[model samples]
Target: MPVVPPPVFALAAGIAQHLLAPDRPAGGARKLASAGIAVAALGLDASAVAAFRRHHTTVNPLDPARASSMVTGGAYRLTRNPMYVGMAGLLTAHAVRRGGWLTPLPAAAFVVLVDRLQIPAEEAAMEANFGEAYARYRARVSRWLPVRA
Candidate 1:
């Protein structure tokens, strides 16, 4: 649960937006992407704030000493890690906007880091804390990507 530096998120999101800027359509696609990013970012931010308010938020590895309640509101309805997912989406939209084929690297790297490192550690801690409930939730939601099936 180590928080990524805000600057890193900002830089990645900026790059992504830049990449996707070119493809930003004048109509539907642009509107949809804009709305999507806004909503996702809002949800993530809200959850993060809630986590902070509850004094359960941390960027370091999940420590029971710092553990808080499991948040399942707002964007958590769509994805478990809304903040991470939202950041990734911002990066992706940038890539799409820029129309840069190479724009996927940072986003992909972000995914790998979150999935392989942050998420697994968080999940383990959640499992230890919440037991079966966390497992069921994990079964229901995909770690980094939304499950289609």
Candidate 2:
């Protein structure tokens, strides 16, 4: 079975909010901030992908079996789920751009769904494939945020 890429799902949810919301708060600064957030989120995504590529692993989120190597540098050093983090960031930016009290709902839902559904499965697969190395990595890194222990 093909799983939906987390980023795509997140982006879709963000876009849905943009489509369903009736109004955007009137402000140039808000839009600029949103744009800045979106750009930064995308940069994080790209960096994650680049790191994966450098590690000679599959960047395709749907095919865990295709992953050829473990990645533990760059964005991976910060968060085990940088791709998901970036996706959430994109969704957050959309929420900011939409500028409604309810705008965050979809992004929150995306994070919940991805965290509960997607990440565990990936972690399991990595543990199965990479064994102790993955365990060490998991022990060292936060699943979402990068905080020093």
1-149, model 1: which lDDT tens digit per residue? 55565337557657654554555444667557756766666667667567655655564444533565666555555677766776777666655444555666776777776677677767878888778887888888766557688
lDDT for predicted candidate 2 compared with the true structure: 0.85
Q: All predictions: root-mean-square deviation over Cα?
A: 4.4, 1.7
The runs of at least 3 residues in candidate 1 whose Cα sits more than 4 Å from the true structure, single-residue gaps closed, are 1-44, 51-65
Clash list (residue pairs), candidate 2: none
The alpha-carbon lDDT assigned to residue 52 of candidate 2 equals: 88
| lDDT against the true structure, each candidate | 0.64, 0.85
Range of the 10 consecutive residues with the lowest summed lDDT in candidate 2: 18-27
Query: For residues 100-138, what per-residue lDDT tens digits would candidate 2 score against the true structure?
Result: 777788888998888888888788888889999999999
Error of 2 at 99 (Å): 0.3
